[model samples]
Target: MTRIVLALAQELAAIVAVGFAQRDEEVHQADPATVAAADLSGVDVLVVRSEPRVLNAALVAACDRAGVRIVPYATDAAGHRLAASFGLALLTTLEAEHIVHHTVPPHREPVCGGVIVVWGPHGAPGRSTLAASLAAECARGNRPTALIDADSHAPALAMMLGLTDDGPGFASACRAAERRTLDAAELSRVAQPLRATDGACSVLTGINRPGRWPELSAERVTACLEIARGWVETIVIDVAASLEEDGEILSDMASPARNAATIAALRSADHIVAVASADAVGIARFIRAYGELRALVGDTPVHVVVNRVRTASLGLDAKGQIRRTLARFTNVEEILFLSHEPDIADGAALHSRTITDIAPKSAFAAGVRRLAADVLGQPDTAATAMPRRARRGRKNKPAIADVAGVPAQLG
Candidate 1:
């Protein structure tokens, strides 16, 4: 038998009589004040009146904590409309004039498609470079990918991918989300297609001005991501450096709005790629920022990408030393080292192209490809595979590293 509690006002007493008469159901009626303080143990469902103050976040949280499903009760048209807007199931008895069975919209779950968020600390840690490369690599592997430029302070994905930023991109999508119209069709229309050579990837450019960061709120960003998932196989988001929330903790009106996009991206990400430069200062900054990243993205898998890995920055055996240090000092277990190839990177940037399109055989490109493979959990045969003789001919091929401490060779 289903044990139900009717936490409704006295005006909606007819629901109690009808519910109690139903076979195989045990119903208990209580006043709104009593219901608020009552122990809801062993109750399968709690039916409450659809009042704004009574159906708030705090009440919802309480019901969730007590393991109860809340069903809103409404006898009047105004209350019914308000209940429907709150996404609640309205319950009415047979004695009511008409049974309005309003179908509640289902909660949207994160798509099966992979969501990889590339983030890093301040000081130009190559966050955009790594995010762009990862997205391009995924697309090159035949995965329909969407690269979101979510950097509120400095939006550079458009310039990096050679796409015009004048059009409606991420900001437009956020506005659509705010208006409750964001969906697969809207996402595809706003995301600009890139001129990638090997595979196709759509770019959702960021705000052209830094002042527009307030527009991309955490809720809106999350909505955009949910809509983008329906249209793509992989969603790669390039977030801002700082994860700090600027607001007064005591006042809701003074709450932080900046960095909302970055925080939302990290929170919603299936996997987070934390990129950090491979220099003394960069490493120090990354080490300090690592704790904060972990705190922000609790229990979410974070793969470390140490970019610009060169002997000049860190002497020989840089990978091994950095790996040991990260493992000992931080919670990082998987570390991918990307060597600095200024010529190749500069060429791609100069021509507004991806490294994969310009120099597919470069070590830095190869490292990024490996990182993409790790993120997707699949080997990128199309881009990473090379002819045996061609592979042998390259004398300066960076030593292929491992994933999760296992040694492996990169083709």
Candidate 2:
């Protein structure tokens, strides 16, 4: 009689038993956690149930190096993370769920969807706020939106939305992508649902730590975004600020992982929201970065958001100065101006309430609402009378989509 270890219990156990029974292998039942902990020096096939088991990366790596196949019947986020770490492929469960194993399947078609990337230049430019706000706004409008925090370094979306300690973030998602085990259900399991008090919006927070960047890559980023697009109407990606500044781990150009994640996100974006500080230096950075971003993502629609705008600094309207500078250097016709609202900083600092919720009547909120409308394809019904030629391929092409208070559009 051939001996086989069985870790999953109940219906899963019966199903595994029958499968081995057909193959004439003797089955030995054991706790799934025990299988993960048991020494497999002489074991042929080790099966473990997918549950609150701590299957570290080192153990999975050791199994691979020693030719021991670790079969994880993981239906949850932890199992998927383990399987991907070990380069294992998942097998289908009797209950119609997919778990991680150690093989590759046939090529399948990728899901069709759109990506909304909220990227920022160096410095705190509020990319997280934009990503969260847009996602929540879309959800509020009854459009399903999946918010992905792709900022591998210094992740802030989870904390911003009060989703820390929820579950695995981008790391788990990437691991699943590496193992070819990523699917809608697995993605949903790992993704913490951002409960909408006003409506239905789904948000998947990013990894909270900067040390776990290795687990997520550009390929995984692409796969996760792809999965999100299929599961929702829009994907709001909150990614790290570009590496224009030195000394940032995620922006370290030398790091292939960092480069891959950032480049992949830029390439995959259907529409991009380029965030910049509202100060003179920030505006200058955006002017320079816009050229580089354009080169990275050719012909993709980009919206420039000048965050934290304050006229008191320049003693005159700083927006005019920034606009003049942008118009002179780049053909970018539109720039959205968001004012400095102390309430926003207070909300984030004291309470975790989103700027949209706490300061809905604030100037910053109003600006973001206009920007959101533009993103959602809502016409500016509040705009004053204007010429209507509807000229094709002109800078004015974006005029129909541009918000009134927002700056000029990028041609």
Candidate 3:
């Protein structure tokens, strides 16, 4: 009897997870040639990992010759094309993580909850700044929040916030998948608590090492977000810029990390903060990047943040000009302009401190506060308007404040 042979690359084993094994009739580890031979005999399906570092086409075609369906777990665009060409169902992280690992029941079973991803189109567009600030703000409002650093190639959120040696980040999460122990609860164990100096609710900071890229796959990313959503009321993602390069090195839009992180976070986002610089080049890139992001994200709420805007320069006011320009091309209705606060920028870029803490009175700090108000859907309020403190100092039960001007309250 020819049995279905499932050959998984070592790394892909963790990525596709063991749930696939349960879904299949028979699962085994074998070289590509062996799978092809089995397929020729009578194997029904060949589940393989399209990890280029290990598996290749010769192995893929071997299965094809056997008239067996080749199911590959892959993430790149190329993988999708290859799977489509071979009439194989591509196992993406989107469905794989959710189906394979189920620890707690789905929190938002019928209705998905809120996920806020902070993304920047190429360049150093203050994505990190906005992400950190938003997380802090949400937690301060007594809303449970989880901050995820999905920038696989350049994972730096841990270092930026001084979170150290807690548990596995993306890479460690991958290993959990390999052991078949990677679940929502396991992820919570590895998460590092990042609380502001003011003792607000903390955000989870992931691993900071580039050597741990393998841990931050699309599957684990989804898992982390899933668990975070259930535990926290809001999830903030600090995404990297896109990876693709331009000819003659003309200019790069968004960081490679941003694109990868954005795609990975799409299924989870209730809101997205698209960060951009205020300069002409930044604006141009934002216009283009916005279109691409919308195409990928559909009609999700996108709040635009124009960072480092100098009031004196560019003739017209920075905020007004950005809104008018964006309106001309994109359908984004909400735009938040943050004045250029050089003092805070110096501290953040060099010292790694939030503007609210360092230059609490600077324009940049005020902008961040205003942005926070907008995020909560409240009218801009004075800085003295602090988050209500708990009477008995209970960490879980925080006094909630309504953002006065925001049209609606986020659940």
Quick one: best TM-score, which candidate? 1
Per-residue lDDT tens digits for candidate 1, residues 1-411, read 667666766656555557456455676777765475678888877777765435544466677789878777667654554455445666654332222222345863332336799988888888887788778888975677899999999999998778888889999998997675766677889989875657889899999999888889987887677556546768999999887776543357545478899998998788898887878888888999999899989987788888777667679877777877787889576677776667777778888887777776666666777777777777555333756765555546444453222111111
Q: What would the TM-score be for candidate 3 when compared with the true structure?
A: 0.58
**Tens-digit lDDT track for model 3 on 1-411?**
224444765565454445554563344556643453453555655566544322334455565576665556678654553344334455765244432332222242222225778887776777877787667766665565667777755656777766673556655654565444554466567666665645354445555665555455555565455434434556778766663322225455332232343476764577778887878888889888877777777877777777766545566655567767887888655666666645445666466555455555554555556666656566767435544552233344312221122111010
Q: Give the better candidate number (1 or 2) by lDDT.
A: 1
**Worst 10 contiguous positions by lDDT, candidate 3:** 402-411
Clashes of 3: 21
lDDT of model 1 at position 181: 72
**Model 3 deviation from native, Cα RMSD in Å:** 12.3
lDDT of each: 0.73, 0.62, 0.57
Ranking by TM-score: 1, 2, 3
Clashes of each: 0, 7, 21
User: Once superposed on the true structure, which residue ranges of model 2 sit more than 4 Å away at CA?
Assistant: 1-113, 243-255, 381-411
- Order of candidate numbers by lDDT, starting with the best: 1, 2, 3
How far out, in Å, is residue 355 in model 1? 0.7
TM-score, per-candidate, Cα-based: 0.69, 0.63, 0.58
**What local lDDT does model 2 show for residue 343?**
47
